[model samples]
Target chain A: MKPSTVPASTPSLRQSSGRYLQTKWKGLIIAVPYLWLVLFFLIPFFIVIKISLAESIIASPPFSSLLNWTEDGALQLSLLFDNYAYLWEDELYYKTYLNSIKVAFICTLICLFIGYPMAYGIVRATPTQRNILLILVILPFWTSFLLRVYAWMGILADQGTLNNLLIWFGLIDEPIRMLYTPFAVYLGIIYSYLPFMILPLYANIEKLDMNLLEAAAALGAKPLITFLTVTLPMTLPGIIAGSLLVFIPATGEYVIPDLLGGGNSFMIGKLLYSEFNNNHDWPVAAAVAVALLILLVLPMMLYQNVQARQVGVKT
Target chain B: MIHKRSRWVIAMLCFGLAFLYVPIFLLILYSFNHSKLVPIWGGFSTRWYTVLFESPEVWEAVMLSLRIALINATFATLLGTLAALAMVRFGRFKGRTLFSGMISAPLVMPEVITGLSLLLLFITLADIIGWPGARGFTTITIAHITFSMAYVAVIIQSRLIGMDQSIEEAAQDLGAKPLRVLWDITLPILAPGMLAGWLLAFTLSLDDLVIASFVTGPGSNTLPILIFSRIKLGLKPDINALATLIILTVSIGVLLAAWLMWRQEKQRMQDRKMASRTDH
Candidate 1:
């Protein structure tokens, strides 16, 4: 180590100064995004909660304030459970919630059934071929979402392409009522979200050690047994991740259900839309939002805990 | 690796791809259909395309959507890049987990919840600060940036994780300032990831309807919002024409990007080979 004779201001001093500046820059870099998210993402969530507790009024902005000034210069607060109570009282809300969950769950299962094998096959393909297959899977994802849904309308209408094809094949006498039904809603969701399911599952399955499967096979394990015991267990995390990705968004999907699901197919998203836009009830809309948030976030909170535990074990 | 079940798996994959593409293919094909009704095949014509070109409402929506998408993609990329750097490079800072969670929340949060909460926030902010006087372009742009940033952050973070850190460290060791190192070395290497993130953000902003619907005021109709309302009434051939044009434009753009990246990779490999030969 140099003991002496080094200049005071040449390299070492400048380097330390640079390090100090770098530290300040680091703080600023992190703070920008951190503060932006807090201001925009986190604080808005609180506002939603506040609005949900307030009463809807026929006024500008359309919600009564929860706070009031008292005659004695003290503050008064009023919060209403009426919106939530109304949500509970209405049997339609219950049906909407249950229907949304049912739709989301079924769509998720369909995505898994369709996506898993594709992912498995792609992972096992030659490297060059795998890239092409992955690109093909992602191509539709880049296209306009609303347009994709609209494409289904053209294909599933009473006189749509599917019915036309079936009629031509002598499979049916009349045009089947495929559009404006729960079945169309299911088809739309599965089609839109299948890529989301496949990508994560592909990532997980691609990382698997093929030797483990080969070892099982050498030990007289059937292909089905090897897959069930090894592959399925190994990709459970991915399965859960992919399922949640599809299911959560599907639950709150407004576009697909509104377009494909006729008046009878009640979804919470469509209900929330009507509450806000048609009914002009901001508080009820907020309440619906809160209910949906809880429905989605509870599973996520549980998943987070499970993930944390898994990380802990791994470390 | 070819097994007894490989054939079944391959067949499933083929079926899945066909299922995914057939509808989109039909939509494109029918865009040029001369018939007013979709299923009945009339002789092919360019009438719908001409109609789409002449529609002022669609053009207005398209212009507005493009403007928002441009602005949203830029802001999302900048903020998302910063957030990704914070998560990847800042090590274990305080509140890192919270920071990450907030960044990722929009990824899975229902669009309805996101839109509603954001609209509420804008309303409250306007009441308190008297800014953002109305919900339209500004509010919609901000909402798009918020959610799209999460996606951009994920893309950039994955890219950062795959990158070699030694090059950046070496630049710093050679007396380059941190900012200089980032600008010169790190950013150049991250350009592809950043471009991908930008494109992703742009497409997301363009495709977004639910959030835009929540935040937009009158006269600020985005393309998706316009198409959505129109489709609710009925599907038209002009709409199909517009969709076909968009798909064509987007696919060409994607293919061009892929080709450019492939060329760049090849050039890099050739350059490395030359450098290795010179070294020997």
Candidate 2:
């Protein structure tokens, strides 16, 4: 549960050219990861910004050159706000984004609902029991995620397991349509991301330091009162972190919405795919991507602030 | 004694497990169904598995996915290990937090966004440089490596942060150069963490479908993509058979790991007991 040993390098380093060496090495250590970010993450984002300003093209890969202003004062390039206008005017992209966010939000709530009790139950169980429960939670993850989603499709289709069961039990006259519905999308998203929610909640709950709740109860607090006063506040950080992990990814999830929700899932991931692969509208896709970046910007900045605060570091 | 409320809690947990596992279990069970209808109970048969193996296209997609996963795992491990080492070994720089944040961003960013962004990059790159002529295996593998490396780095960095810095300092004091200190002191300590990170990255890449679908081009489909397209049309029982095989593999792997850890824990306890006896 805790690290058993601590390395003694600090004292020795402090004895020798310490501050200078530490400063230099720390700077160096941070650079390798920094460069990767600049190249793969940041640069790609900047490029998307640049391309979003351009006109759509029909090529193997779709992008156009930057529109530089003329030296004499008149604008030289054919750059315009067509893509942004299109996103506003066209009903589909905005609808997709809205739907994706809606699904992610609702799924996050269900995951929290299901996961909280399970997490609490495990933490209250014996350590052996907790370990077994945790494994059971993670075991499904070890299988191929796509294949598992595929399995869900087989189970949820009109003629699938639920329908078959209904007929066999004589509960229904005809099979109910399930697959390709928004309900199916919700099912897929919740099922897939539930583990992401549970693991963090479980980690925080298991380390809840039961003595606090026990002391509160001994002082005459009810079980519900103690949980509200003691347990809930302590696990706020983990809850936030877990939701970010689940909701962010679920927003942009492709396969689940694509398969279970079918073509009409109206998720942004499928829409982005359409712009690039089907619609051949690169500029529009890039612009939608810019919208995505803006959407992610606020929460991501919040996450950064939290990370900096974790080590008591100022940023 | 278990409380009344606790039983309800456990029952709730059991329902969650059913929600998670029943669909997959059903997938496995129905793999043996002799009929094409997924849920209809037919006489048990292994024909689907045989048919799955016989399909060359499926095999090729599986093989391609394997190759991509192996390559991605290798690159991710290397970059992640070095980045992790740097994060710990190097002193905190002006933008240390920023760097860490950037590297770890992929872990939380939606694979959809990551894929979308990367695909846009590939297209933009092609327009600018005319290299990587087409977005296919190479591009997809590169994309996987980029994200997987971040995960590996995070895991390895956590391990390095836990490690005692004194061991590496001791090596340095004993006439070892910086590189030699790293090679001897740091690497041995980091090996287990890196290996664990590598396996984790491998599994993640193998499990990816959303991102792969975004970045993958025509005629270069990965197994997950292939399976997904088929499932979209409708799930075949053979898909069930495939899921069963994968489940078996992971179950066996986890069981073996648990056994090994148990043995090591027992040995560690015994070793401590002997050491205490010697002191006495």
The C-alpha TM-scores of every prediction are 0.92, 0.90
lDDT of 1 by residue, B1-280 (tens): 3466998899999999999999999999889899999767898999999989998999999999999999999999999998988876766679999998898889888888899899889988998999789889999999999999999998887677567666776778889887788789889988888999999999999999999999999889999999998889656888899999999999888878777877898899999999999999
Candidate 2 Cα outliers beyond 4 Å, as residue runs: A1-34, A58-64, A68-79, A304-315, B94-98, B273-280
- TM-score of chain A by itself in each prediction: 0.88, 0.85
Clashing pairs in 2: A7-B164, A25-B90, A25-B91, A26-B90, A26-B91, A26-B92, A27-B91, A29-B86
On DockQ, the candidate that comes out on top is: 1
Number of backbone-clashing residue pairs for each candidate, in the order shown: 0, 8
DockQ, prediction 1: 0.58
How would you encode candidate 1's per-residue C-alpha lDDT over A185-233 as one tens digit per residue? 9999999999999998997788688998999999989888998999999
The first chain of model 1 has a TM-score of 0.88
Q: Rate the local accuracy (lDDT) of all candidates.
A: 0.87, 0.78
Best by lDDT: 1
